[model samples]
Target: MRKIILSASVSLDGCFEGADGGLDWHLVDDELHTHFNDQLRGMSAFLMGRVNYELMARVWPDADADPSSSGPEAEFAGIWRETPKIVFSRTLDRAGPDATVMREVDPEAILELKRRPGGDMSIGGARLAARFRQHDLIDEYRVYVHPVILGRGRPLFEPSDDRKPLALAGTHTFGNGVVLLHYKSD
Candidate 1:
């Protein structure tokens, strides 16, 4: 079965965004962006929340068309456009091209997608990931930790009474001081 991967970037302090609720600190240089492109190129689908989907839709759709876009940026734009997207939102009536807008996270539907033959699906957005985490639906977790630390901000995981253990699968350190910690559900 295809797996559901929860992938995200966080600061050294484990904050997804700064106090101002922005991810401008993410060290996404060409190498890192290329790495992201390589990793995301094969993803069969992307599970996202409305906020994340809108954020991406604003920039990525025309990023390649922009003359100032870098090589990796253009490449990633293609990858993003090609991959199927499933946006979970009650407020959105439509989404970008190659996207399906769903009102909620349905386990059976997710399982059906997993059962289909293809590459694994990635889930982004803290809220969407939280819902999937609560359902114990994520098969893998890939967290890219940057070098900077924002003393306080939104974390990838919210406090929960439940404890979900994960096994370390692998780790990779980029030249830009970004570390990718891969884990599997335990």
Candidate 2:
């Protein structure tokens, strides 16, 4: 079965976003953007929350058309457009092509998707990832830790009473000050 990978970028202090809900602190330079494009290109699908999907849809869809967009940005635009996306939303009535809007996260249904023949799926959004973590559905985690410290903000992982063990699968430090920590559930 294909694995479910929860991929996200967090600060050194463990915050995913600042108190103002802005991700401007994320140091996604050309090298990191290209790395993201390369990594996400092989995914079977993206599972995300409505907020995450909408935020990406607003800019990525037309990014390639903009002349000012960098090579990596344009490449990522195409990759994002082609990839199948499943957005979890309570109020969303519909979604664009190659996308599905789910009212809730169903573990059985997600498991079925993983059983099918395909590459691994990537789950985005902290809240959605928390839900998947609650169900013990995530098989791997690709966390990119930035150099900054938010001090206070939304954390990458939600609070849980039970402790989960993860084995370090791999690690990479980019030219920028970001470090990728790949971990697999033990």
Per-model tally of clashing residue pairs: 0, 0
What is the TM-score of each predicted model, taking all chains together?
Answer: 0.97, 0.98
lDDT of each: 0.93, 0.93
- Tens-place lDDT per residue, model 1, 40-116, is 89999999999999999899987999999999999988988899999999999998769999998888888888999
Q: Model 2, residue 162: what's the lDDT?
A: 65
lDDT (Cα, 0-100) at 59 in candidate 2? 96
- Tens-digit per-residue lDDT, 1-186, candidate 2: 999998899999999899999999999999999989888999999999999999999999989999999999999999999999999999999988878999998999988999999899999999999999988999999999999998999998878896889999999999888999999998
**Which TM-score value belongs to model 1?**
0.97
Which residue pairs of candidate 2 clash? none
Q: Which ten residues in a row have the lowest lDDT in candidate 1?
A: 104-113
Error of 1 at 144 (Å): 0.6
Best by TM-score: 2
